[model samples]
Target: MKKLRDGPMDGDMNGNQRTHNFRFLLALAILTPLVVSMTVMGLATFHFGRLSVGELTGTIVQQTVARVGAQLKQLQDVAQDQNRLNLKVMADRPPRAGDFKRVAAALAPSFEVNDELDGVYYGVEATGEFFALLRGTNQVVNLLERTLDPDGQWSRRISRWSGTDWQFLEQLPADRYDPRTRPFYQAAKTARATIWTSTYEFWPHRPGDRRTTGVTCATPVYDGAGQLQGVWGVDLGTIELCDYLAAIDPEVPGYPFIVGEEGDGTRRVIAHPNRNMVIDARTGMLFRDANGIRDETVKAFLRQIPGRFAAHAVHTASHTVPLRLSEFAPDSVAARTRTFEFADHGTNYLGGCFVTGRDDRLLIGMVLDKKEVMRHVNRNAAWFAATFAAVLVASLIGVFGFARRASRPLVELQREAHAVGRLELAPSDPPLSHIREIRELGNAMALMKTNLRSFRKYVPADLVGDLVRSGQEAMLGGERINATIYFSDIAGFTPVAEQLRPEEIVEHLGAYLQAMSDGIAQHSGTVDKYIGDAVMAFWNAPRPNPAHAADACRAALANQRQLDRLNEQWRAAGKPVFRTRIGLHTGPVVVGNIGSEHRMNYTVIGDTVNLASRLENLNKLYGTRILISETTRAEAGSAISARPVDRANIKGKTTVVTVYELLCEAEAETPEQAELRRQTEEAFAFYQRGDYARAAAAYREILQRWPADGVAAALLRRCEELAAKAPPPLSQDG
Candidate 1:
């Protein structure tokens, strides 16, 4: 029509051009709905294609890390627990060569080797057999002993004749337990720790013919002279531990796997899906591979593997690629390997090595990506998707009444997609869509993009966000954080519990945790976890707490204040009130979710937890309300009100981590109490430094002034004894 206005064939041409433009606009109107529908479908595909798998894998990895960390920590706990008992034993009586029997007897109740026993046993290099406590009975069982010798591997069996209680006997070469040479013996003897040994002989062939085995945990025992004595420890059967650990993923149908490397055979399947496939879970006994199983399938997977391992590694570097087996998916999706699992059969090629430790041998491997065990089903789903798309496209051509209605839904979906594509994390409060599914999807997308802003209130939003993107962050695992630990418990809770109804008890406990949690948070601390009525909190993790020590001290004081207030209220209501004892410590610990995938917890662990608990209980001795470790006092400087209580070792820790009392703002007698603390510190230091004369004089003056000082009394008695004995420069050197 405009061209006609330039002077040729005017009216008719103008009408024709107008008609054409109207048709073009109609076409655009129809195309708008189709384009939007396709865009919405594309967005959904993105989620299905990549995000879903990534989310699932991330969740699994987090859980796996947490579970593995916990299991290893439990092993550490068992070692430390036994070490404590051994320490007590050494303190009570010197280690004599003949004390092995008594020691083994003492370990009988908890050291059994059965399904429930969990491969708990102690071994001594002086003796030629490994020791186990019989299940449900306090009987010492010898796994490999010269007493049952004059035989070979399979000849060994469980017998009651060996002792008044059940005993197991297996024989092996003499050097395996020669106190002078065994790996377990050597490691324990060298340090005051339950040391893990390198890979050696894992299974004993006979009762007396002791052979080498894989890694073990050995805790040393000392005699009165502090001379090196035999070791009390636990031996882990790689096969057995692997089998039990393999059961961790029981929801999946296939057998779990543990892969390790024995010296002679480099590429072998150490443990497999079938419990009896290669070795017995209980005894590590060799079993025949049953017929009619998937031998080809197993071999096929193994054959597909590629390896350049640092031998075997549990803590493999991120860049390290072990035997990578493929699930052989078609090139329809952008995925190669979805998961990693260890071979279950005896000594498979894909094995985990405890690279973090001395030995470079495979301990075990897990079967990863079991959800896709049935590829056929996944392939069918893919095919069904493709067919559905074809039908959808063809239906667009029909343009029937129902088609338009269905297409209308797709049309609206497309419009929302375009709107989302235009919108971003800008601060505008855009109109939220009315459609429920659309609104939810849009919100989810927005949340993902703005997670840093959303979770900022609960966590240090920026740091956690970066960690998530880098895939270095884990929801279920814990890190070894530099933490100021705080433990607070209801002081007279036992008697209080007896007095209250069950519901009331529960109510009180709930109130206690909630109050503790709020206080800890306000001071920038995380509740590491709770133990019954006790609350354990920490600072400097999941967020930066620069004033962690100061905050920890403040929190302790706050809890005491809160508890005092709560009790006051309770007493006013005619309900009995209880006291709370708080303990704090600063140290490095392995913190994480301390449980399995299905059932897990975010918590902290190590000797730190034990020491903190010990500190809480030690309030009984000091008559102080709250106690902090010497480390915490040093870090807290003047911000925390504390006085060193002692330089003595706790029940678990080998090194003495001195503890102190934390004074609060509300105590008016704090200055006078602090002066008394100063005097006590000087007196204790004098005694510790071997100036017994000055120490005794100071102690006597303190007792005269404060008759109720128990520490002063005990120190006075010790000082007098030191006055009689040789007053060396200092006390015992640990």
Candidate 2:
């Protein structure tokens, strides 16, 4: 028998220990240089790949943006040419009152020839009269005339083109909408040349007609004597312009948008791929107030270059850059075209900015997701990495067969570690290793897996799964997503807590929260966090739920019903009963695990969350148990029965949001509850429309039927106060 060294082989050692020692050191020495060389080569390959991909992608994006810019410039030029040509043809001899019809007939052919022109009009400054031919539809044309009266008043006459002849439509009421006051008219009068107006909504002849956004090209018309007479203009509908912008190749993975300077020196979005991004979501109105724009990308562009651009620099970065928007305003650098980079919600983007139109006021920009653009580069890089790794593994296998045999136990331990990293811990006995260091490594990995198993209980399982799948220890950033947030708080928890002992309070509160959490979990909602006596949860995050809004509403109702059962049990046990108020709102929010490096929490933030909290607190004002925003009600559909509470301008937000009280499930409502809901809706409708007296009567009727209805009673008081304080009507004589 031979004696063996425990720790290391000394000058004299046993045959087995020496053999193992030599093989392990030899394998390490061989693998070290191989890994080092492969890492250096891989880094170099990745660096060059990024450069080549970035350059090619940037060039393609620049060309696409430039092409869009050129098309926009061509549109402007066409408008100017049309305006100049018509002005010259009319200026050859100024048109008198009788010659107006001839001038209109001369312009009528222009519309038939040019499909780009939506309308042709000429305004006479001398007579305060206007004649125009507008395209009502693809086949129908309308002729409009505004005549000045002897008393300096104006009235409009509309005639429809019925293919064979012009049919008289009707005379419109008098209004102060004057063509002379338009920006295009003013600009042409001031510049004495053909000029283009900023895009604006053009209303049709009929009342309550949908308005189409368009641009006008106008030129001041003068007689042979060079005296200013009137302005001749042509209208170009933005439908064609928007269509052109949207028709850009989908393969490009970028969108083109047109920005124009408004009269107030604010930037307006003239064209966008999704028209709703340019319009107010709540109002369905196109945004003219730049500060009121909700689109963050558009706002960022406008804020970078205020008014007119003289010299602007574009910022570029290879890695993901913070999307603060404020950082986009760069130092002065003059360039006709520039490429930039930005990051939003963990995705990198490349964009190009090109000045379009003659005045240099309009900007055409295209943004592409860098990941989408460099997809081929990433694939190539992956192939290179995989090939190198495979070669390294093959070389190791060929050189170290005996060493691999010695490391068989360690390989099993490595697999265990990987499984632990993936949050898939399966119970297994630690493998025995002849090597002391290898055995200790296996022990440490087993300890880590055990600790991780315990830690999983402290964290949300879904969030843990996300982290494991993403191969990240923790998420540090948030993503903007459309989610429905639910907030619930005990209506009078403070008084209840004060009345009970601390232990009892804790017990009851814990039980209440547990019940509510169960309800939320049943509906696939993530219980984000709990406050002192409140719970906040959300749906459609960490996973997608198409019915997130309806699910949230159902969860809130479920929570209330569950709380009722819990309160009954508490009452039977001689404890305090709890009444919870819940608020639900559906909108865009930023959700992620956010906090310090050491301590983090998965939560949501944004105005949507704030509004939900506000609605939760607002329950006290209306004495309602549940309240939800208009967006939530709309998304909840017919599953939930809700009555309008009020259209309130929440404290922080400028826009008003309509709130509704979640009464019950539509199918579960009794006849009395249905009638109460009907009466409440009618009263609220009157209240919103400023009919306080009728609203008061309606609320009184509801109180007569259901006197305990706190919401109706509250509204009745409000209506009475408003009606009493209302001003007296003006006398007929006055």
**Every model's TM-score:** 0.38, 0.46
List, residue by residue over 1-734, the lDDT tens digit for candidate 2.
Answer: 35443334644433454433556676778889888988898899799878888777777766676566555556666666777667666657766545655566666655666666778887777765777888777646777888876686777888776555567889988766677877677888998876667787775656865567788888787776877798888888766676656766645767778776654566777777776677665544567765665557656555555446424423332212112122222221123457777765566777677653444556667777777777767887889989988998897886577454546787788788778767887667788977787888888888877777787766666787777767767847889999999998887789899998889888878888888988988999998888899899999988999999999988999988888888888899988898898999999999987898889888899999999999999999888999999999999898899898887888998998999999888889988778888888999978876778889999999889888888888889888999888754334585
Q: Residue 488 CA error for candidate 1 (Å)?
A: 2.2
Identify the candidate with maximal lDDT.
2
Point out the worst 10-residue segment of candidate 1 by lDDT.
Answer: 325-334
Report, for every candidate in turn, its global Cα lDDT versus the true structure. 0.56, 0.76
Model 2 stretches astray by more than 4 angstroms: 1-438, 457-459, 665-673, 727-734
Each candidate's number of clashing pairs is 53, 0
Task: Please give, for residues 129-233, the per-residue lDDT of candidate 1 as tens digits.
Answer: 444433223433443222324454322234332444435443334443343466667767776656766445544434543332345667766556776545665
TM-score of 2: 0.46
- Itemize residue pairs with steric clashes in candidate 2: none
Question: Once model 1 is optimally superposed onto the true structure by TM-score, how far is the C-alpha of residue 484 displaced, in angstroms?
Answer: 1.5
Query: What lDDT score goes with residue 451 in model 1?
Result: 56
